[model samples]
Target: MPVTHATGIGPVPTAAPKLAPNVLDLFSLKGKVASVTGASSGIGKEVAIAYAQAGADVALWYNGNPKAVETAAMLEKEYGVRAKAYKCPITDSAAVEATTAQIVKDFGRLDVQVVNAGVAWEAGPMIDVEGHDEWKKVIDIDLNGAYYAAKAAGRVFKSQGTGSLIFTASMSGHIVNIPQMQACYNAAKAGLLHLSRSLAVEWAGFARSNTVSPGYMITEISNFAPKDTKQKWQQLIPLGREGNPRELVGAYLYFASDASTYTTGADLIVDGGYCAP
Candidate 1:
């Protein structure tokens, strides 16, 4: 494939590599093994589905939602791939490492890892965002969780020499919002974007790493917000509506597929123009 190509387009192939593998094959995850954190709900669940649709065996990690067990079954049935679910606490580094080890051991190989599990503490300003009791918790899960996942996934990627790592960031990482305050959320997400980019550069020549920053999506997570609050969010999005969790499937697919073989250290914003303005 040509080393350089058009935007959002896969690399152009002039002739097949002499001894190197077909880089186009990099886009196909068939026979690959994938692990996704926060696969129990919202964007996480859809990400797992997209990977499965790409033809990879999957290990889903969830902190809550007994439905994760069902999600696993459904994935296996629908995608014809082996699927397993584990309840994991990404906030704990050791636990994350151990669980990731178990997944690789069980699956025989771990090719893709998606750090999608995160929490947002809601309130007024940063001070009110999270009290002493909750402040640390929010930072721990949102920011620290990404670190743990990256460390755990990077280990396997480094060893294998070819893997994909995906981080779920937010449009909030780029722009601040009004009406409802979530300063802590914004800070954590912003950190995650850079973290993914740093890892991408560090892991270059061995593995691929990228971040997907999504805007306000309509999911069970936001279903708890008041109607007027959600409506206000719609007004903020240039699409004149909140995004659906499923809308992010295509972006996730591109990052996880060979379509982005030559791409790394980049931010794929599937924010429906929320960050465009």
Candidate 2:
């Protein structure tokens, strides 16, 4: 008889199954299908490409950028893998659920879901901002949006008995940034850290949950910061520079692949030593 967890899910294996002898093979996502939100550009785009190169069929989800469609076409052609783009506004829970289900239907199965869609909080300090609109928007997309994706994907994972959920959290989740007042963004990301960990336990019998907290990177999301503000950021970072989006793809890939089968409820920080000090 199989054991059941508190969530009423069946038992997970007690021992590791026979895996490929070659270490590299453990990282291969061949025969897997992944969906990535915010895949129009920046880190999301890079991760989509990395997934394709690693042999996973990819569904690129974008809300405002049509470039994802072209990128999907390129991936399908160059990597000889199935790729497609979907217009998914993660802020809408119903839409997120529908899109996730569609991806499973389209790809035949959903193996990994990356909740990467988010916007930077631009309105200055909370006290100075007019009304609560900005705060709510950030919370809706950054925190609530992730929950929508996780809930939808978690259902699929439970049904399939296996899946990986990776959230694109930020260093703001772990440490408060100096010289910038983005309490909303920080709060949202911090919430994500706990949310992922909570789900890691709740869904342990069927899936894994983890977060990737990236520091200041050269992405459009940070374009709002002025030159001097960024300079201050570099000074604070021990590496004296911002990270490239490509540099963070490995962490996302690891969490999405067989290489991290035993890992869950973890946050991998790629912050160029900023949080180190």
Candidate 3:
């Protein structure tokens, strides 16, 4: 007899579910409800648009920029999908929980959640930094915020018996970046990688957890860096250039769709092969 566990825990599956014979169909997000944090612009905005284009109703979460509202409207008009912008401060655990719950309430069900909200550590080396405030802020948003999202979303996934959780980690998590001093950012992202993996095992019976680590993407987050700094980044990247935000969406799409059903506890790095060398 098969051993039994809690509702959202195992009895691990013994067989794979039959998939659509058409490979493309597996990539479709029709009728699915997805949510992306940090969706005001850059990588988050691009992912939100891509999800809408693929037929998922999306909730775009933003903290400060109101551009997300306009983006949502554009998605509705252009993609003909239900899309809405929400103001959510990821640093606040209560806000994160409430916002996530609100998305499920509005969308009826949430199939995918991408916790991509984060801040870059512009403050140079940790030791020379003025205060602990900067370090705490980075940890609060990048690491703690992600954990809050997983807890809130994990509950819904457990109840619904299915969901996908994706984190926007950084290549810095895998390797120490040169020409830049961001110990806090690196630590937070490294924590994210392990957090996702741990959640994958914990939520395996009902949901999947994964991460996408992008390297030197041309996003607003990097605007603080000088051109020469970026030039240094380009030299380290095997592709010899910074990646466009749009270029990283394919990995996000794969993790959000049925195409990655069997892929959990994984980190898909779209870093222009920077980590290769």
| Model 1 regions lying over 4 Å from their true place | 1-27
Could you estimate the TM-score for every candidate? Answer: 0.89, 0.95, 0.95
How do these models rank on lDDT, best leading? 2, 3, 1
Per-residue lDDT over 1-277 for candidate 1, one digit per residue giving the tens place of the 0 to 100 score: 1244667475444332233266656556788898999999899898888888889888999986767789899999998999999888999899999999999999998888888898765655766443475677778998998899889888898888678898998888899876778787888999998988888767775788899998888777665578898888888888898888889987887787777767788888887788787
Measured on C-alpha atoms, candidate 3 has an lDDT of 0.92
- Winner by lDDT: 2
Candidate closer to the true structure by TM-score (higher is better), 1 or 3: 3
Tens digits of lDDT, candidate 2, 203-257? 8878899999999999999999999999999999999999999999999999999
Please give the TM-score that candidate 1 achieves against the real structure: 0.89
Model 3 bad stretches (over 4 Å): 1-11
Name the weakest run of 10 consecutive residues (lDDT summed) in model 2: 1-10
